[model samples]
Target: MGKVRKHSDSESDDGEIEFKKPRPAKKKKVETKTAEKSNDNTRDAKGDAIFALSNKRRVTVRAFPNGEPAIDIRETYVVNGEQRPGKGICLPLVQWKKLVELLPDIEEAITALPKKK
Candidate 1:
């Protein structure tokens, strides 16, 4: 005759399941040397581009009376937008042609001028 089985429903006789510990996150690589050099180069490039554009011809820039960019370019001042006068600074008519020749992205550059006073 086979042995009879017993059943109990009080609590788990076996131990609880165990989980593996999570690994630590990896740190990002730093490029301090390369980053520092690139910063100065970037600024120099921007300054050169602006200087080249302005040196071709003297284009005067003025501050708007209402503290916004002016709409029309004055004979003496280079009015750009209605909100700020100097904000729309550009090369003279003759120099504009040259500027466009030097930088095809002149339109984008001018449009991206700062709006803040």
Candidate 2:
């Protein structure tokens, strides 16, 4: 039998020298001017609110995707003389329906609570 040959770092198992081809660097994502213009227009076209409850807190119900309803419940406050939108819960149509169904029980629970002094 022939003697076994040792392989070098740059050599393949068959003793052929290997050269690695340089790969192109990945390109970063850049937002185009057209994309920015579309986003600006979408921001300007705010959805119309169908129902609103305004007390100490403000809650609004608006239709999204033309027909589906969404409820946004948030606090009303002012900062630097400008009214700023408060962070709050947003319920989609299904969850909003569930909340409506549970309203009777919720009212009962609230009525059962002791009155504040």
Candidate 3:
């Protein structure tokens, strides 16, 4: 004779039971030394190019993760005998372009201001 079993609430009337196993957590990727070094090299090269210019400032146009265009403006300065970065500003690409287009008018307005004694 075959063995008989009592049915639980989770078991179907047809005598079949469903089981589910818990999934394992995903692991985060670790950055390699070579990748870090390459990033540093790229940063150094960009810094050199910015400082090599007479303006000592650079504007980088990039896209955000959400697909919005952005402009980053950074300036280099000498602080305590070492080259350091100054305060930076970030704006939308449209605003940056508008600012560029209005540069001549802005300069004229600035020059029109009365000089301080």
Sort by lDDT, best first: 2, 3, 1
Cα displacement (angstroms), candidate 2, residue 40, comes to 29
Clashes of 2: 0
User: In lDDT terms, how accurate is model 1?
Assistant: 0.37
lDDT of each residue in 1-117, candidate 2, tens digit only: 234455677645666545555667897544322111243231112533423256335556667677778777776555544444577787898998999999999999999999989
Instruction: Please tell me which predicted candidate would have the highest lDDT against the true structure.
Output: 2
TM-score leader: 2
Residue 22 displacement in candidate 3 (angstroms): 68
Q: Tell me the spans in candidate 3 whose CA falls farther than 4 Å from its real position.
A: 1-56, 77-86
1-117 per-residue lDDT for model 3 (tens digits)? 333554678645676555555667786544322111243232342332122234456555556678788776777665444455567887897888899999999999999999999
**In lDDT terms, how accurate is model 2?**
0.59
TM-score of each: 0.21, 0.46, 0.40
Task: Give per-residue CA lDDT, model 1, range 89-111, as digits (tens).
Answer: 53444555565587857777887
Comparing 1 with 3 on lDDT, the higher-scoring candidate is 3
Q: Clashing residue pairs in candidate 1, if any? A: 68-83, 68-84, 69-81, 69-82, 69-83, 69-84, 69-85, 70-81
Model 2 worst lDDT run, 10 consecutive residues: 35-44
